[model samples]
Target: MVDDRDLLKVVSGIIGEERTSDDCCMIKVGDDNIILSTDMLHESTDFPRGMTDWQIGWMSAAVTLSDVASCGAVPLALLLAAGLDEPERISGITAGAKDCCERFGAELAGGDIDFHSELTIVTTGIGRVEDEYYKTRRGAKPGDIVCVTGTPGCAGAALEGSERYWKNLVEPLPAVREGRLLAVAGVSSMMDVSDGIALSLYDLSGSSCVGFEISMDNLPLSPGVSPEMALYSGGDFGLLFTCGRDILPVTGVDCTVIGVVTDSGEVLCDGVLVERRGYSHRWMEEI
Candidate 1:
């Protein structure tokens, strides 16, 4: 069976061009460059119980903008496509989208609308970057410290029926500021943990062709979150990065050193091989 990764490979092969697994695709325009990314949230798969329409709006924008920030791009605007029937719901979604843009300093330029059987929101983020400063998921080397921008696993906890963690799940704050700081700090490689940390580490390993030795004890966990949740939970939206030098102090962001890059292609958590157990599309179990 072809999984998501396999499907991407097949599509890339069909396109006949070298493509990246990076969250966003970048293009050079004149002296500078522009980055583009899109993300969609469906009510059936994404929306948790007891979430407000405002949070739904906010998260749709945040998820797409997270991709923009991961590439060290300054958000310019957002294009939204909302599918719904209720006018009130649409209003809340657009309002939340507007608020998200305001918070992140972007513009909700325009979007489309359609009525569908289920609610769906697709947002496209537009961002700009200096030609030399864009970030990617490659370039990690041996001796680099692997770090995460903020605590993780809250969303996982929420999925496991934690009411407190529900706030984290519905109203996620994208690490845009942290991503910008890491870009300026000259991070070797970085990505957001929208997927589980285990899958994320495997991705980084494959991209940079380097192994990682992560200390499970070093993972910065949210309160009431277990090791399994911290490792396999997705929707964290924290920035995970590697740098050859020590991390510089960033205001308002909690940076934690969790592991080190190695030449071997093994990803370990406290001397144990990290398993591929996470919020898979087929099964989002908290084991």
Candidate 2:
């Protein structure tokens, strides 16, 4: 018999070790602080077979950083859990991870490795945020404006076609400084567009019993990306936040008010219902 539940159990155990995603999961213990986020880049599942070792390594770090970034936590360090085919490949993976992490001002604190048939990189990041203006998904008001930074659906769109999606793999994540900027602006709430905007909105609206109203026409899609997919694509890695009804003044980062928070759980695209949510653990059978 196979133990399919083993991984789920272990993951639950690890997250349960502390607390998982609830009560906002934090501890004030001493000077060292912690914010836990995990991202797994499975070769077969996440990337196309022909992906370069460098892209694989870089993306492995970027995705995890997205979680930390959305939390408005200043990324301080990262640790890797890898399974490599050869000892030599470890150098490439480490170098790739180092280049990406350093680009974002985080350090390769430490990591562990084991041998495997295929390469697997799991990144765990730890960061700390000041008590003041620490962003959360919990504070959006009914009339708050829904704003997003940079373009939407770039990462996901880049993965779709020959010319565009591949090019974005190397495009540095627009995180770090921008997230801090939004927080200081006294934004009501924030989250990164890791999963499509739709799923992310629901995740952020958790327990608050608040829903979101999004204007699809206002969605900022990258030139190479399509609007049809932008509405529900994942991996964009842009910041989606809520503020007052009007767009806030910002520099360096492009901001747009694409929606408004509401008391109902239904999400609308210019007053119409949207289908085909975000990503799935299985093949993307579009809804």
All candidates: CA RMSD in angstroms? 3.0, 4.3
- The parts of candidate 1 lying over 4 Å away from their true place are 16-18, 85-87, 250-252, 283-287
The TM-scores, one per candidate, come to 0.93, 0.86
lDDT of 2 at 81: 87
Q: Which stretch of 10 consecutive residues in model 2 shows the poorest summed lDDT?
A: 1-10
Candidate number of the best lDDT? 1
User: Candidate 1's residue-wise lDDT over 1-287, tens digit each?
Assistant: 33556556666778643455777888878877899998878898888867788899999999988889988888999999999856669888989989998899899999999998889999999999875568888888999988887788999899889988787888889888888878877888888988978888888888889999999899888789987888888987998888876555656667898899999989999989999666556424322
What's model 2's overall lDDT?
0.71
RMSD of 2: 4.3
lDDT of 2 by residue, 1-287 (tens): 22322344465587772354321344676864466677777777676656667766777777777777776778888898889877787777788778878988899889999988877889988778777757777778888888888777776766676466664544437477788777776787887776778766766666345777887778887776777666677767788888885447856557888888888876667777666367546423322
Please report, in order, the local distance difference test score of every candidate based on alpha carbons: 0.85, 0.71
